[model samples]
Target: MSQQPKSSDDENQTEMYIRVKRNKTTYFLQCLPSEKVLQIKEKLQVLIDEPVNNQRLILIQTGEVLDDSKSLADQKVENDAAVALTLRKADNEFEDVNVVKPDDYIRDGDGGSNW
Candidate 1:
């Protein structure tokens, strides 16, 4: 009987461990090497407080941002890979409530202090 050659997928489907560093915390996750980055992000959303959309996962070894369309295998994310997590700032988040500006010093055309 003839046997078919094994595909790379077969070789890469093995489960692996990935470490995530976020917010001064380290999280360890078990996952398949072939799992999509989106899937990993979904899981991360569950484990971490941040939403997936706001989270940026960086493969520490490769220094590449994990894309939603690519799989860990495609990124060559090996077993025990370390991923760094960065949170995307929302438009309103962390805004300076009282920012000083040069314009603030200038008075309006109206002499009455346009406070």
Candidate 2:
């Protein structure tokens, strides 16, 4: 089917495509320049199952991370811009105490074991 060409005014009003890359996957996200960085992360979370807090979007050309407090327009992000996706590591400092050993338990006067 043939489609009519969009007018310049219509084109200006339409959302632009932002290419997102993660490993070998590429996602073309429709974004408005006025949208906040956090909004973009929220969109990515729904599309790719990436947690919003864990996502780190970097500009492919400049390697600059998108600031959560700024709008896309503030960064001068234009249409058809490419972004690389990275994930923040989970909290590895948490000690897993699920498997308690005998040595980990101390006996009190009442003969009760305490962790």
Candidate 3:
């Protein structure tokens, strides 16, 4: 007799990750498609020490600013997607997207004289 594979909990089954970038940093966060943008910001708050009110998430592909009240799926944020993270400045303005690509990194072995 043939048997089907066992399934884990629904939460684990629908788990996915997204790469959130800010400057030279990237955070890999595990989230569900149904999760709201605010939820994702809360997770970032713990890691970045920034309050959700001061945080902003933008989709890198389309330059769309994510609404905190909407779910990831509702905004078409699929798994393995890249999102830009911006923060509110003291002037109460959200900073521009500032993600740095790998090619932007300065190499140390540029053959400069140590002396």
lDDT of 3 by residue, 25-80 (tens): 99999999989999999999999999999999999999999999998989999999
- Residue 48 shift from truth in candidate 2, angstroms: 1.6
The sequence of per-residue lDDT tens digits that candidate 2 reaches over residues 18-81 is 9887665778899888788899999999998968887888787787888988978788778999
Clashing pairs in 2: none
Ranking of all candidate structures by their lDDT, best first: 3, 1, 2
Which run of 10 residues does model 3 get worst, by summed lDDT?
4-13
Model 1, position 110: C-alpha lDDT score:
63
Residue 25 shift from truth in candidate 2, angstroms: 0.5
Using all chains and alpha carbons, the TM-scores for the candidates as numbered come to 0.67, 0.65, 0.81
In model 2, the worst 10-residue window by lDDT is 92-101
Report the number of the highest-lDDT candidate. 3
By TM-score, is 1 or 3 better?
Answer: 3
TM-score of candidate 3 to 2 decimals: 0.81
Model 1: residues with Cα > 4 Å off, grouped in runs = 1-10, 92-115
The TM-score between candidate 2 and the true structure equals 0.65
